[model samples]
Target: MEKEFNKKLNHLTKVNLARYSTMRLKSWGYLYELESFHEARAVIQELKKQKRPYRLIGGGSNQLLSSWEEGVYLKLPKADLHLLSVDEKKMTLSCDASTTVNAVLQLAKKYSLGGFEVLTGIPATMGGVAFMNAGTSLGEFSSLVSFIEWIDGEGNICSKEFLTSDDRAKNFSYRKNHFCGEGEVITKMILKATSRDDALEEKITKYLNYRKETQPLSSKTCGCVFKNPAKEMPAGKLIDGANLKGVHVGDLFVSTLHANFMENRGEATYEDFVALVQVVKEEVFRKFHVELELEVKI
Candidate 1:
């Protein structure tokens, strides 16, 4: 069975990774665009059995791809974006991991679901958002997740419920979740929907407008670079207080519009990003006496 699956899985070599990650760093490596959960499971088992390093990425909106030569990268392609089911009575929606946040919002709107409006402007797949507990001041994805179906390291399909009484629910916290481990790929998720809101469209527009005004939405960035240190002190505010906005290392510059975002002006390398991050961290700590932690994955 393993041999048969291996025959079907293929990987591309020395693929340009700029298009895969929002950071747009000039990096190249092997890429496995798995078309199905079966393919993903097979790939994981093969990679593990061969002792080869691998990384899984979703929409790449929150990842900084540096040296890709160290490991092969796996991703669920657009073809995997499937709206599996929706139960209006139960206020639940189930979707494939690769389904974009926008797609989910559109479906939610069709059914008059409300809570998803908070995720408006986040350019990520459902799997990525759930894995990172992605959200804004409005709310986090953890609050909406009912359960997640994933491909574990051993090529087994596993599901974990996130009910309040479930101990696994504790794995979720600020901008992070531990349910999905290293090399485990989230395949699908069941999200708890909220009551009907006729104003869902207006709410989405409002959130979108707010993000447009405060974030560098058009810039080549990996979203927010650091997580908010506290409710009172946002990372952007801290960076601004440290006077680190507009700071640059090569073409990677701290966005003036949003201090938490680092923009790739042109031809920025991974080294430039690292240097800029170090500079910002040191200065922010010096001025605020608080250590800033990164929100984006490297």
Candidate 2:
């Protein structure tokens, strides 16, 4: 830590009144944002000392924050981007938890790299996306990742590779990665991608344009409120059929644009969002005999 930062730490706290998400009115979380990998490790130790539970945070684009949290909210600080190496046929990018996924994608696009382009419009950092397996049909982040690295609870760095089928099985669902537990923090991620120029740009433009038209790119809410069921029914369509296209509770309302999106209209409470989610589920189940499962982290 720098001399100035050490001075700031004297006043820095684990508990904070910070807005936790980018969309739908703001909800509150006790923000414990870290700015460096060392700072992240230090913050985890602090939380362990206090014996308080905490959740990791990214861009806050795809999650809901409660107005009142039951535990500490750990956010990776905002200056962890470090470009490790970019090769001829493949590229390797390693980033701290604080680096947003968009930043990495932007860097790769400028260099004419292709694999990360599918994630062009998705928000959050590479660490967060890797943890949650964030992706779109064009591709999920897991498909592009070759190895993952993180800081253990003991404060030691470790790396894991799941490129082969056998190794990949350990991850229940790429979307359901359970490695971090409650207090562990991701340090960086290394991924390999095909090197292509014209095709990569074209793919990126198509996905980005489609995302803008299909999703409320301008609205606030965690992206895609629920996961698609294995039975082939989309949660959004179910919610819409149940007549929840304009549903609202407090300032939280389902996006008029997409049923799966819950817009935070600038002053909604976390309670409102949760309540609306319940309503959508119950109504859908009552009428269709199908239960809607939430994918949003609340």
Candidate 3:
């Protein structure tokens, strides 16, 4: 049965998960890189028949490979689905889920579509980006999305269209989008377009510059380690205020440039990262009376 399942997927066995994850924490698992939504749905169906547990991941930018044992890890390949389409009349761009957010933004820019310029430096696929509702202070992916197509828990492809502004904002919050189940998978999305702008180039430049200045962009780390407790009390500020910067457990240390980010200074283990996170959380709670929630998925 395992052999038969293997035949249906682009499979790799006992892969070092650290290579796939942004934080580079070593873990091993079977990886299934699905080529299309049909392949993904078929894989999900087979997993159900076998009663095998599975997880869907993208880019691995915001994920932590802590305990991925006895489970199948699913991923859409980094290659674009070549499903891009433009609707000049409606001012919209439709793309497949496997497309990177960077690619989507680049396409938007090429076509002169505005609005996604604020997401310039983010590193994630369209599906992961939409699922997390990723954004900075400028705005969120949810604000630009028109509708989504995904595989639902029942192994059926479902389309959810945002009919109103409130409907669009329904389940999204700071660093969160709650539209899909754990077993569900987002396959495609349509983004509401803004008119072409020559000034968008400058806007994207400003956003990229801001991220470069504040984030440890060149280091090996998951984007942001913790969610902001409140607008006035950002997680980094709190961790910095607690004097936790440059604190280390093994080779994993709190990034001095941004306390909310933990950098892996080579030879770091998942246990090391976890330990450091615990220390920071405990210390932040002890001193500030505020609990920090992780932005990165574990």
Candidate 4:
């Protein structure tokens, strides 16, 4: 069975798949560089045929495949923007999800699009943002999405859900719509954006400056370490208030730059990240009459 599995796996990486995907999750993993969507589909088909395990990865910016699970990782063939279709009349654009959010923002700016100015600090693939409904303290990611193109189970491509007003009474509670499901995938996104003007440029500048001053942009950290529990408070504030900044477990430590970010300072391990999160949760619960939740995948 194992031999059969390996026979079907394509361009497998060197690290023990188990260790790379889970125990030693890092900025690096079974590094396979693909070049197109068809190649990915072929691999997925083979895995289904061989009954082998695999997990799709994009950006590798938000994930925590635990040691307890075993699988392979698949990625979009490349990180290029497959398409960027703008509609000045609607103030929206259809974007490729494989590209980074920053790239999308730059594209938006080139076209004088305004809705994405608030996302300057987020550094992730557009697909990832949709998968997690990623957002800031002020708002959620889904609010800007007018529609999306996704691949459903069985690999059948589908388009934006057309719902009536009553059918759309509830916004996606999680704020994620485009990317979802273990076996399904998302190929692109369509965002409801605004046309830019002088005022929009000023707001963009403010967000860009905030990112420079408050985030560890120069380091190897992924992003925020934990999600804020609600509207009134933030996770970093809670952790810092508990005096947990700079706390360490192995090579990973809560970043001194921002208490909510746990960073891998060269030798950090999965164990270090997970253990430190436990510390933050405990300390915060003790200090405040509240509990904190993780923003990081692990």
The per-model lDDT (C-alpha) reads 0.84, 0.70, 0.83, 0.65
Instruction: Give the C-alpha lDDT of model 4.
Output: 0.65
List of clashing residue pairs for candidate 3 = none
- Model 4 spans > 4 angstroms off: 1-11, 16-32, 65-69, 80-82, 161-171
Predicted candidate 3 versus true structure: per-residue lDDT over 1-298, tens digit per residue: 4456557553445678887888898778887877667777878988887788888888889987765667788876555557877787787989988788778777777777778775788888888888888988878888788889999877888888886779867868777777787769898989986566777767887888888999999899999999999998999999999999999998899999999999998978888978898999999999999999989988
Who is ahead in lDDT, 3 or 4?
3
What lDDT tens digits, residue by residue, belong to model 2 across residues 8-54? Answer: 54454444333557764454545656667787777666666667677
**Candidate 1: residue pairs that collide:** none
Per-residue lDDT value at 297 in model 1: 83
Predicted candidate 4 versus true structure: per-residue lDDT over 188-253, tens digit per residue: 877876445545556777877887799777666767766777756878888889998888898777
Tens-digit lDDT track for model 1 on 141-212? 877888888887787788988777354458788888877786788888888865778788888888899899
User: What ranking emerges by lDDT with the best candidate at the front?
Assistant: 1, 3, 2, 4
Better of 1 and 4 by lDDT: 1
Better of 2 and 4 by lDDT: 2
Per-candidate clash tally: 0, 8, 0, 3
Leading candidate by lDDT: 1
TM-score of candidate 4 to 2 decimals: 0.83
